[model samples]
Target: MTTIPSIIEELDQLRPVSDVAGKVLSLLDDSGCGMSDLADIIRHEPALTANLLKLANSAYFGLPGKIGDAKQAIVYLGMTQVVDLILLVSCADTFKGSHSGYGLDRGALWESAICAAILANALSEKKGFKSTGLTFTGALLRDIGKVVIDQHVKSAMPQIMERVETQHISFMAAERQVLGVDHAQVGAMVAKRWHFPPLLQCIIRYYHTPLQADGCFTEASIVHLADAICRKMKISPGVDDSSYEEDERIAHSLGLNETVINGVIGEFSEKMEHVRTLFLAG
Candidate 1:
């Protein structure tokens, strides 16, 4: 088996997308970036522009007419949706691959990420949390570490599986025992390298266990819960036992009743095609 490089070394070798997301957010916040400005930013990338336009006109958006340009798309979709779309486009390639170590096949990771992101966004909306755009992006890419860590996990599969089978341990724990680091840590390191917002870095790192965070933002907790929910619902891409204890505190923090959570799952299931359409549309 090839030796997995030290976390710091591995991080140093990869490019971060957070800086790009930050710049995009800054431009959006500064307000000098109107539809024209948005169009200008996307124009240089024809593929992104075309895809954005496609999504803007998709059944998900329910627009009155086809969006002919990026400017029009942004105006109709609203800046928040536009930004979310851009972030989605930006992270597409990174999340598309299979992580066989985790049993994700081609497109499996992407589907899981999309489902988690949608649920995260839905939960955020339900809780009235602002920065829904950032929450959605963070949730979508939250598992990014899995991409990099899969190779190491593949190498250490035998030992890791042994632990999981015998110890009733989480896969992440097994991963740490065999590889010295887990996907969440590796993912957070990568997000930091990308210059992603500090909040996102935290979510990437701790979404699995958000109550442990000192500040314990409700948004992070929502994503954490949403990840577990997605896995439990079998929306996850790969084969996971999906057996993790719930953080009851998150439910309380968000004032989430079982009814509301159930409703969201029903809505999510109904709208999944819309979600898939946004990403998979030509």
Candidate 2:
């Protein structure tokens, strides 16, 4: 039998989405790249450019006029949004499959991930966090490790589920017991391999337990809340597949009341189709 550790070690060498995504990150590193510069980069990839233009004119943005070009998109959507949209579009390929191990069918895991990213972005705005760029991208990519780990897990599903049922353990804990490493660690490893931003790596690693994190750039609370919200909406298949509980600290820290949380949830539910169009069209 191939041990999980060995499989992971071998898989670690695979760049997956890193090669292309790394270049995208590099181009946006300074964040000073203007519309023309960004347009030049988008034009380098014909398909990406086409998708960008299509999404810009989609109902999600609701511009009065059609956005026929990358430059027009930047003008209508702003540079930060344009850059974030590029990253979102480019990263979608990394997660366009099913993970039977986690019981996520085609696009199930991806849908949940997108919801998490959307909620994370909404929460960041509510909390007045500048630059939801990193937060949105980080939340979206948080489960990249699962893409790699799910196959091995699918093969060991029975044992993992039995342990979860018998011991009442978290899915991640069950995963660690059965596979010798959970998705969080595997995700961090994947993030490092992909040369993702350090803060993003941390966000991926500690998303399940934000309060335990200690360092700069803590969006742990945001990710935690977003994950809960997505699960409640059945966007992804959580291990237990139950409704998510509120992290009281997270809400308190953000000064969120029940009304506000409910309101955001309502908004998300209403706009989900629009958001879905943005991602799918890209």
Candidate 3:
């Protein structure tokens, strides 16, 4: 078996976000970027421009008449939401594919990821967590490590699963024991290679083990619950299945009791169903 350091060092296949999305991310991280500035940057990507225009006119936005202008679309959607879509579209090639090793078919990871992102955004807001956009992005890109380590994971599944059953450990823990690294840790390395913010790196690194996250424990916890909810609900089973246990204490810490959990499930479903069409059209 390869050491974790070697596995990380060998991760040269990590996909870089598109230049336009990279620029947009830089500006979003900046404190001074305005709507006009964001519009100016997105206009250079013709496909992104067209998609934004389409989404701006989608029924979900409910604007009067048509919005043919780039600035208008940016204004209507807000920078955070626009950035969210950009990240999705830019990384589509990377995340929208099937990873047989991880048990996700084509676009399964994409569906689960966006679903988790939407819920994480909502959860962060409800919990009064700072930087909801960061939370959303972290959730969206949390499992990217799976892409790098999927084949290794798949080959080791027999041992991984055996540990899960015999040691009373989560599937991810078994992954660590078998591979010396889990998807979450590999995901953090992926994020670092992609120039993701430190907080996002931390969230991805410890999403499956939020208690290990020192810098962004709450954010990691939010991502954890979101992933668990998706897996439990089978929103997009991927390869991980639904073997991991949900941390009720973590949910309680975020004020997600049974009622809130039920509400989150319902809201997550409704939101995905309602806005997915817009995303597809875009």
Scored by TM-score, the top model is 3
Tell me the whole-model lDDT of each prediction, alpha carbons only: 0.75, 0.75, 0.79
Q: Which lDDT tens digits does candidate 1 get at residues 1-282? A: 434466557666555554445566566446465666666777777877877887788788799987998888878877777888888877777777778888887777888887888888888888777553367877888888888777677778889888888988887887778888888888988877776667677878888877765543665788887887787788754544453667677888779888888888989989777777667443
Clashes of 2: 1
Clash tally, candidates in order:
2, 1, 1
Candidate 3 Cα lDDT to native: 0.79
lDDT of 2 by residue, 28-123 (tens): 555665568777777778778887887788888789887888888888888767766777777776677777777777777778878888788888
TM-score for candidate 2: 0.89
RMSD of each: 2.8, 2.5, 2.2
Put down candidate 3 lDDT per residue, 1-282, tens digits, no spaces: 656776776677566778887787777567887888888888788998887787778777688878897887766766777788778778778787788887787778888888888788777766777553477888888988888888788888889888988888877888889999888888888778877777789999988878778988888899988888888778768546656777778888777777777787887777666656755323
lDDT score, candidate 2? 0.75
TM-score of 3: 0.90
CA deviation > 4 Å runs, candidate 3: 1-6, 128-132, 280-282
Candidate that scores best on lDDT:
3
